[model samples]
Target: MAIEKKTIRLLILEDSQNEAERLVSLFRNAGQATRVHRLTGIDDLNEALQHSWDLLICAPSSEALDPTEAIAAIRRQAKDIPAIQLLANNDSDDITAALSLGAQDALPQGEDERLVLVAKRELANLEERRGRRASEVALREAEKRCQLLLESSVDAITYVHDGMHIYANRAYLELFAYEDADELEGMPMIDLIGASDQASFKDFLKNYQGHDGHAELQCNGVKANGHSFAAQMSFSPATYDGEPCTQVVIRAHSGNAELEEKLREISSQDLVTGLFNRNHFLGLMDAAAERAVNAGQPATLAYIRADHYASLLAEVGLAGIDILLTDLANLLRSHFPGEAQLARFGDDVFTVLLPGLSPEDCREQLGSLLKKVESNLFDVNGRTVQSTLSIGVAGLNEKTAKAQEVVNRAHRCADELSEGNGLKLFDPADELAAAANRGSIVAMIQQALENNSFHLMFQPIISLRGDNFEHYEALLRLHNPQGEEITPLELFTAAKGAGLAEKIDRWVILNSIKLLADHRSKGHETRLFVHLSSASLQDQTLLPWLSVALKAARLPSDSLVFQFSEPDAIAYLKQAKAITQGLNELHCKTALTQFGCALNPFNTLKHLHLDFIKIDSSFSQDLGNPENQEALKTLLTSLHSQAKLTIVPFVESASVLATLWQAGVNYIQGYYLQGPSQSMDYDFASGED
Candidate 1:
């Protein structure tokens, strides 16, 4: 592979234009491309220091520019450009003085070949310093993310160094009956083990080199209250806080099936609504299907979708949505048998499996339930809100071979309902066609990934306040084998089903970084906003991977802002918070997109320290309405009061711009400005205030 040549921006603190040209020629003659700016005095040097530069070459003997004064100016600006001082005479005292004054090196003048070599070496050193800084930032981000994971893990985890406990997660503290981690810190690891096991544990520790990395041992655990429990302890060698340590994971063998079952429920169930999650629900469906087959019984699945859920969510906020879902779950529980399986499926969908309900009975029951939900006035923060449901019923029979097929058919029927409030029964023909379509989409996604056929487009996030910095949001596009574009919604749905969302997120991040780096190389100070999926939010390795990619591209961390949708961030709040905090720690900004849709969306802002909030497009869509304008104004005011930069997207008309400007939005993006294009060619300066 051939290495691409890089252009270095050089600031020359030389009074003589001729000598500056001579220096530039020397670099060029040595096969180095340079953009040279000559600074004749302190003012010129100060102005030049405002922008980024690869290296600074100072002529110490210049009458107008003093090398020491120039170096001090650069220091005052906090610029990190490597500076080399050219001495007219090769004097030890002068070289020492220059070196002490923050000059990286001093070179004797009149030696062109030596000048080129020293300049090149200094530039290389500058690049190395930048790389190291990026690595340090990445390391800190990784460590922070790891700490978060450890703290949140359900398994009792502890880091031991020299037989002393250095760190312990919440589960570990609870396991040992300690009230706080502070109580366990610096405590002896053996204190938590029974006296009978202490001797064997010590022997095991003495002989353990962690060469195998992971090993489990059965031991007796003693709690703070002197109660002992059987425990299985797994040990692995790990690094924490830059030191070698042993990671101990303790799984208590309480021998209580109920406790194990409860733990499983906590992991697989939704906390707020207490409904089975998508995965857990599907698992239950599979088991129910198997039992139905064994008993030769009939089973029917109902897929319930909330009508106009986006509008409801906007009205209620996340807290209100939670209350709505909980109420809905309770309603389902009351209407159905106790043994009926209910789950919170997708964002606005719910699923119920009735093991013995016939198609007619299932439809009647669900229809009545829908009527009750539609008639009920939900009190959301003193406001009465009504919601309706779309029901799809799929009855299991000899032909229903797979649980997923039934579930998918029910979902499809619910989605295709002409009247949102009515119910539809699944058709076998529709199921077969839908399955084929899904398979085709999955194949397209796989081929796109393997063949590197995905396309990236950038939409300019123009500053309403006339900020000089350029910003663009990176958008991804996928195509089928036939060359027709596949919408992101379709592609992502397929990717998520195939468990490839993380891979897609990684691809976008890497490509966006490469594009941003290339754009920056052309003398533009541009920033790219990249979207991250929920998989990336939970992925502890993403930060480290991103750091390496940024360093490889030689891009500053600040030049990339990672964005997460408000719904996704809420769905995976813990992981989102951790990832955002990690990104901020790495000096990268984060934006919550599709914001202001959730009822009480500000609640999320209180928990997350974000740099930007992209208002949901619904707000923009309703801008023409006076009431919506007021709402937008109010939302923008609240966001600005909290010191958040606001970005309003989907600005399709000039009429909306006036309202947005009046609302004091910090940034705006939509087709009206420019749709996502193959190039970042927006004239941001033209729209400056």
Candidate 2:
């Protein structure tokens, strides 16, 4: 089957981040961008399963998780995510075990072509199953609506199976002068006709059984009161409650315009919140996008999510949650008034589209609304539940080409918020820049590499204690012809896509070594932590090349600490373990940035030897929250227990300094001390707190 979707939402149960990327790259290379989340344990798996996922690829069993348990979790959630086990070494026993654990297929880890093949097949099959389920649900809903219309309909209608009355509407009962439908349910169609017309009615029924279209006959009808009346009866093939039957309508003059109108109204409305549904709202979004792009109109789309929704679910049962959502919806309706399209995106999530409004205007409106929601106490089941909102706003301006893309950007902004009761406005410039420069980015990168124009900046990783250690993390930067800076994220993403990541990594490493050696010559035992791309982790010759470069610069290998993201190390666990081992042999230090992001971060540590571990910047960024502060303290204790020096980055204020000191963090880096600079001039000996 051909893969039609441009994006695939994937969940990987692999502990290694490099391996996960390998799977993701397969989809990317096949023109399918992926939104992937790697699961490290059952908890991570369970949390990720809350969202819709296309595929699950996991190791048969790892120290962090079991594939069987992951499958069980998916089942427990009643989600239709397809699971496939990626086997190590392709052992027959492992294959048998993985299949027995309910994996769709067990395949070797390195068979890239075959893996894509099976994944596509499974994705296609999953789509078919979801489609079938949706159709089934639609059929059931349609049946209920039709039954409702039949009951309220003015025309006298009855259903007959095998010449015996199976069902009769209220109109039919009243037309036959019966008090209730049960009195006519078991009665035969022939019994309802007068004796004078029974023969003709029997003939009409017999002929209509062979006929596919409707047939009508003028007949005398006998009521339950034994009174006869001239009536026109129409017969047509129909199904009632899954059984084949013939519908008989008497004097059917009125049509079903009212029922159709009711169906249309409900189809566009959400039953829970009484707001416009997702499908209808998306149509409005598309129209807004078109207006923004073609008619020069500007609109703002806001994605609002109720914070701590899972906790709220625990506080209120499903029915109560619905009531709370409805209350929230009503508040939104009142706040927006008219012309603003409000929709229930999903459970506890709402979307508001403000037409003819700039993002700034929208932000102001949302800010006011945010305060109202935060202060207002919602009543659910006679209990008060106060919840905050996280709103992400994006402008549907001339640059907005796709409504879905705008939705994704707004959602991403909301998800990126560290705290609740906050609003984030998505900057469209970065997205526009990336797209506008995609064609020239590779050329710019090549020019930078050939001309040796790439430059590095340093940010001091200061010690929380009064130690005289000068440490900085090296940051890479690039400038285009317009003198605009391109972030390392954008550069590396383009480089990897263009297959220049390895060359770029080598360039950064060589330049970093030279700069560190020069900085140390000034009688400063300065140490620099340089980031390496995932490509460099897989480069078997990187260690040997680094050894030559360090010797050439006459710099001690330990002074130039090499750092890669935790995700990179996890994705290429085997290579990371080997590279770290090789670096250790060369007396070099290695550190993992974005550490503690994995489900079992320590599980990756078990495979490699590293001297320094930098906690993910989010931990430092969200230190204001007590739970985050405690989590950071606990993580620091664990790292210290392992004899590993922990570095906390993104320390932007004095407020977190006391916590870091109490947590015993070795080093801290952020704007609070000093921002990145061309020179390593941070006065570490100043003794400033």
| Alpha-carbon shift of residue 427 in model 1 (angstroms) | 40
At residue 551, give the lDDT of candidate 1.
83
lDDT of 2 by residue, 76-97 (tens): 7778888888876778998887
Give me the runs in candidate 2 sitting further than 4 Å from their true place.
1-439, 687-689
Candidate 2 weakest ten by summed lDDT: 428-437
TM-scores of the candidates are 0.39, 0.42
Alpha carbon lDDT of each predicted model: 0.83, 0.84
Q: How much lDDT does candidate 1 score?
A: 0.83
RMSD of 2: 19.3
Best by TM-score: 2
Model 1 per-residue lDDT tens digits across residues 6-42: 6789888787786787677555433345788888788
